[model samples]
Target: MRAYERLLKYVSYETTSDESSETCPSSPKELVLAEALVEELKQIGVADAHVDKDGYVYGSIPATKGAENEKAIGLIAHMDTAPAMSGANIKPRIIKDYDGADIVLNEKLGVVMDTVTFPHLTNYVGQDLIVTDGTTLLGADDKAGVAEIMTAAAQIIEADAQAGEGSAHGKICIAFTPDEEIGRGADRFDVEHFGADYAYTVDGGMLGEIEFENFNAASAKVHIKGENIHPGEAKNKMKNASLLAMEFNSMLPPAEIPAHTEGYEGFFHLCGMSGDEENAHLDYIVRDHSMDKFLERKAMLERITAYLNQKYGEGTVTLNMKDSYYNMREKLESDMYIVDRAVEAMRENDVEPIIQPIRGGTDGARLSFMGLPCPNLSTGGHNFHGKYEYVCIQSMDKMVDIIKTIVRKSN
Candidate 1:
């Protein structure tokens, strides 16, 4: 089956991960897709295909007789969709040969995807695009990756059956992870048991994109304490916590934010804020590609807290910070050949390699540090995690071929 066809079936299952949930898979619904994937793998001739207790689906295709000693290559993609948008009951429509004009996603909701707001629509003018309705995300973020990998596996098995001894290739390991959108995709991963020398995460955006560098991430929560007083009697004694929270945010560099930064630039994003007269809270996520700069950013948060405490009195502002993940480039630098292999595979499949740094983190970023020198590959998706999300059907088909080439050339 074509990758896009598989994607349509896969997205039918509601697999939106919950960050607030403390469970391993974050949501029990993810296991539904995980089990289905295992069944599909088994049907494709993988004897040991199964979903583990942690909701990770694993299966391996053994090497042909002559290629047994060659290096093992692994393909990885996540199963769960981001919790930022509704993943339930997604209504996807295909735009056959896009006309580079505004697309009315939902006439009733007055939702339109205009070329002026999303100029990248022109890039896929002559290509088929799978897009979401006005209500929900398309789930192409990694489902496209999942479908491409699964289709590649099916093609390899069919080729082996037809060729008898099969086209020369090494062992191919496949894994579909859960909760990647919430950043715990690799938390319980068993790298040693996966039995691959290296892996590639098919969780990136756009066609031909190969990412090895990602942000060094951290999360910060700031709390403010203030005394509430009646408005009529309030004077110099009243200290509003909500106003104090705004002051804390005003201390940050306005230009160094997600809206203003791009490429290699780092940012301090205020993800959420809540406040009242007595107490206030601010949640932020810090990101930088450079480790030194990442550390400096954390220190800057500490400095801000200290200065605020001095100005408002000690114990008034409380800051809590934690590191999320480091740049995978630090771990993959020594094993650069893995990245080169992907580049060659893309070129062999008639796709130009676009090596760029990921503005966001992927499961591969943490996996690389877990002794799996993994880089990231694109799923031919765009505008991930939102209703404007889409994927080029032509690009998804090409990605399947590219994945097949990557594994076959491993011999």
Candidate 2:
């Protein structure tokens, strides 16, 4: 199948991962798509295609004849969609030759995207686009990446098999992972088993994106214990947990938020907060591109909590903090060619490479630290993980070309 064809089909699988689940795949639904990918990989002539017990699909295409000496290159994409939104029953609309205007997703529901906020629609004018119906996310975040990799790999194999005398330089390793949306995508990746000299995760948004670095991330949750009293007779004896939660938020830097920060800047995002008198909880995610700054942000939180406890009481607050991932640029700096190949490939294809540091984390960031030296490439998506999600078909086709050219020239 073609890249868009595979993308449309993959989105129908509804592999939405569950962050609350204890299973390796997070959600068993992810395995449904993983198994299907393994079958398709085999159909496309990838040897030993199968889904591992941990729900990762691994496949290999042997080197084409003359390209036997080239080092193996790996391409990866995630299987599960984000758990934050509904991934079931996706209705994808293909806009043929898009015109820059307000797109009415569901006419009766009165859903429309303001061009004022998303001016990038002008960039995709005259190109075909696939979007959601405003009810659920389009699942294009990484499905487009998976589709591009699968189609490109199929084409490479076919080209090598047809012209056996002039093949690419080496074998190609491919993987489709589960639970990437939940941050455990690389926990059981088994990088040594995939066996590639270098790799790229086709999980970025927008065309021409070449991401070598991303935010250093950590998640923090604070549970506040409060004394509840009857509102009718409430006085200094009562401490409203909800109000305390608000006070806790107020202690953090106001300007340091995702809505305000961009491009190498750091932020403390308040993901969730809940509870009332007697008990309350606050959830925050801290991110930065620098390790020292990331640590400082976490320490600042600790300091705030300590001060709060000093005034309110020692047992008033409890904190849970965990490090998510670090910047991949540190690892990629030693082997910059991984990023250069992607950039040069875009330049060779007449595409202006948009090299930027990702404000969010990716599977590649953690994978690079795991010794794969991976970078992120574009999957041609926008408005990811929401009802406004969309993908450009032309960008998907171009990504396939980029992957093919990389393999053809790497040999």
Clashes of each: 0, 3
State TM-scores per candidate.
0.92, 0.90
Q: Could you tell me the lDDT of residue 181 within candidate 2?
A: 90
Report the Cα lDDT for residue 385, model 2. 84
**Candidate 1 lDDT, 1-411, residue by residue in tens:** 899999999989999999999998999999999999999999989888999999999999998768888889999999999999999999899999998999999999999999989888899999999999889998998899999999999999889878754377889999999999998999999999899998999988889999999999999999999889998898987889999999999989999999999999999999999999999999999999999999998998899999989988899899999888899999989779889999999998888999999888878989998889999999999899999999999999999999988888453
Give the lDDT of residue 292 in candidate 1: 92
lDDT of each: 0.92, 0.89
| 10 residues in a row with least lDDT, candidate 2 | 160-169
What is the TM-score (0 to 1) of candidate 1? Answer: 0.92
Tens-digit per-residue lDDT, 20-72, candidate 2 = 89998998888989999998998888878999999999998877666667778
Off by over 4 Å in 2: 65-69, 164-167, 224-248, 274-280, 309-317, 409-411
Q: What is the C-alpha RMSD of each candidate to the true structure, in Å?
A: 2.4, 2.7
